[model samples]
Target: MESLRNLPLLDQLKDQSISTLVQTSLIALIGVLLLVKLVQRLRLNLPPGPLPLPIVGNWLQFKEGLNPRNLAELANKYGDVCMLQMGQRKVLVISSPEMAKEVLQTQGVEFGSRARNLVFDMTTGKGSDMVFADYGEHWRKMRRIATIPFFTNKVVQQSRRGWEEEVDLALNDIKEMPGSTTSGVMVNFRLQLMMYNIVYRMMFSRKFSGLHDPLYVKLMTLNLENNRLAQSFKYNYGDYVPSLKPFLKGYLKEVWETNQRRLSFLRDEFLNERKRQTGEKIGVDFFLEAAAKGEISETNVLYLIQNMNVAAIETTLWSSEWGIAELINNPQIQDKIRNELDRVLGKGVPVTEPDIANLPYLQAMVKEILRMHMVIPMLVPHMNLQATKLGKYDIPAGCRVLVNAWGIANNPKYWEKPEVFNPDRFLKEKIEPTGNDFRFIPFGSGRRSCPGSLIALPILGIVLGRIMQRFELLPPPGVDKVDLRSVGGQLSLVLASKPRVVLKPRQI
Candidate 1:
């Protein structure tokens, strides 16, 4: 019996030795293949970049997250158009306004499509949504369908009155908060609720009851989670390095599951409800009508709603917060805007969408906010369909392009005293957010420029203007000024500290 046990143990040792040998052989084969690929890559006359290591090219450089600050430092080292090796992939970081136009506008078509990795592919339903969809006939059709309800001048006109009322309701909510009049209130939470309500009304023809509502809370929670996952540089690292994916399977699975839950909520709660409606018309009726006519698929409709909620809500919420915080910090600027509102619309008069046309200072202030605090600093990444030359640099086909809009805006070469928060700069020179002036492209440009700007501009102006009209904005006690330090690694830049302010209702 002892001999039989010894024989079995010897066989087990032999099996282990064979497994170890096979693993070693496979690794050696892979290393050789990677070396060949590296040699081929070096042979190409690509743009200059730091030396990359095998299998994990330049991945270590962006451990802090590939944010504006990181990209700006790289720009200083390498000229405007610098190449970065993110694993096996090539990325072009365009830091200057001239290069930005060359990629985003001049040759927008060449780099028109978005590059999706494993995560983006699942979240965007294989890039069917307009924002990430490849530049093609399908994308054009989707954009047209979306424009009817979201971007057109008619939609903005129809939604303006509802938006004004929502702002007033939000102001009342803030006023009702305990000690809001004297001790002040944290406006960030309430402000986010208000911004969501504005977009919610536009999308569903109604607003959530308040922040405490169960459905509202659940939706907000899911949206926040989704945004965090989408923007997390650490979470999405596998997208840049394919070899790292086996280790990231669990993380990717969670993200996919979360996105599915978000989509399911939209379908069950919102899309199905719209489909059931007969006598009543809602904001989503246009989409439902198109679905019925087979002009757009049901899946695409659901994703479009998901796109609007995620894309429109948080960015707009933060923009409002930033604008208001800046106003509180610069009380003189706040007073000037209030005096302008009083002059144009009279004291205590609620600002309407059309009133934005007459408020020059308000417009300038908003532009300054956009310039100073770029919401989406690094705009959506673009992909090149073919090898292209950008200013004597040979960019390989399928390389990703990231336009550093924040860097461009803050580059001292373009704007004098770039760090200062002054709206007066715009008063001297005329610039449009239309993305035509590459130096100040907050909304992006070309075929994929943000379509919601027409709606966004008026809504932002109304909310900020009305708040200033009804209240004397002041900073929270003990805090001398608004903290401008941004929390890094978000899809959009967000305030590290949620701004707190006292909204003293004017005695008009």
Candidate 2:
């Protein structure tokens, strides 16, 4: 009878223990919720954005990823400075010129560091090159080295003849193409070759024989693949969501493989060859000397070469391609360019670098194209090294900062009829693309602005001016106008199709 009574007591004890456990769990859960609310209260001053879901955080809304169009849409709703929680990462999109000035110039030091994602990290070798490196002593040294040999006024003066000669060579090749005059010729390859030769000669004292040259084709293929992989929006999700990273193994592998191939080709074919020669200073010679002096590693020198190959060649090519296509689409613009060239340089005289200053219309046209179709819509992203206040909101340290150069340049408040491509707007106004006028920062502004702008501007004028001076760029037979539809990437705005134009030799 005593044992049976003890069993009931034991059962009561077990029930009491179960009740206590449930109470403890409920208390802990409530405490966690309160702590989370407190943390949210602390961050309540963060810029306005759509509420984000746990783990995903605004990612589900971006099916195409965080492209300019989507970001612009968000800016329209959220205001000039909107914060986005992309998974765990915080992105601050600056869409107004005033905010851009604040981020890129006013507190530039606080927001001067480069934002490195997985793809860029791989390509830049963890911020080793000048263009993608963080703002610091190493970056300063690289920038100093790059500016001296390749981007300075002295370098431009010395290389002008070679650049012009490359253009002339390309023109000669176009003339030799079968049915080039009547059936229309695709000058894209020739133009790409000309750009390659111009940069390659400066860097390696070398140039490919033609567009079809095995080495040229290989290099172009590799670089195009590299750019495609690096600039793809597909790779961004993995960077934003750590859990999604395992899915990007194949993509990351391809990027790494492509980078390795590019490095090997550059090292074996160019850098190593330059190492064998001892003579007057070329671009690589400076880098080689820097490596020899223990100022920078040989790996850095190779990356510098990689940067020049992509940055120097690809960007200029896109601009030239866009400029020429725009001229073809607008015959009136072409006539204006031709008339200016003839009046400025005289009939049949080619456009020289120094002559560019006298051609205000040409300069305006360059500005217009850069403004109308910014090659890099979201200029290489910037990051704040420490927590800082931007306008009314608090920006967390290490937040990725993107200035929508496209949105700013195209904002109606800043420019009248911003969508229209009228170079006359630039002619009437004194806005310049040298990052002075924040409304027109195609090459960006501040310490991280493209140093190659000095070279790019002159090249654009020379190439377009010469072509207009020599040939009438017209659309293919029976085609009303070249398709002006552009495909936008995270980093570039390229034409949907390669333009083919009939180059009728002008009787200049």
Q: What are the root-mean-square deviations of the candidates from the true structure over C-alphas? A: 3.9, 4.6
Clash count list over all predictions = 0, 0
C-alpha TM-score for every candidate: 0.92, 0.92
Off by over 4 Å in 2: 1-38, 41-44
lDDT for predicted candidate 2 compared with the true structure = 0.88
Candidate 2 weakest lDDT stretch, 10 residues: 32-41
Model 2 lDDT tens row, 293-348: 99999899989998898679888998998898899889999999999988878999
Clashing pairs in 2: none
1-508 per-residue lDDT for model 1 (tens digits) = 8899799889999999999999999898778867875776677767677777666778787766678878888999887888888787888888998899999889989989887667778888988888889888888888888888778888888888888888888889898999787878887787778777888788787678888988899998888887777777775567777777799888788889999999899889877876666765656777778788988898888888887885677777778878988998898998889999999988877889888989999999989988988888888788998887787777788988889999999999899998999999988999888999989998899988888778778878988898888888888778788788887553478777877788888888
C-alpha RMSD between model 1 and the true structure: 3.9
Residue runs of model 1 more than 4 Å from their true location after superposition: 1-42
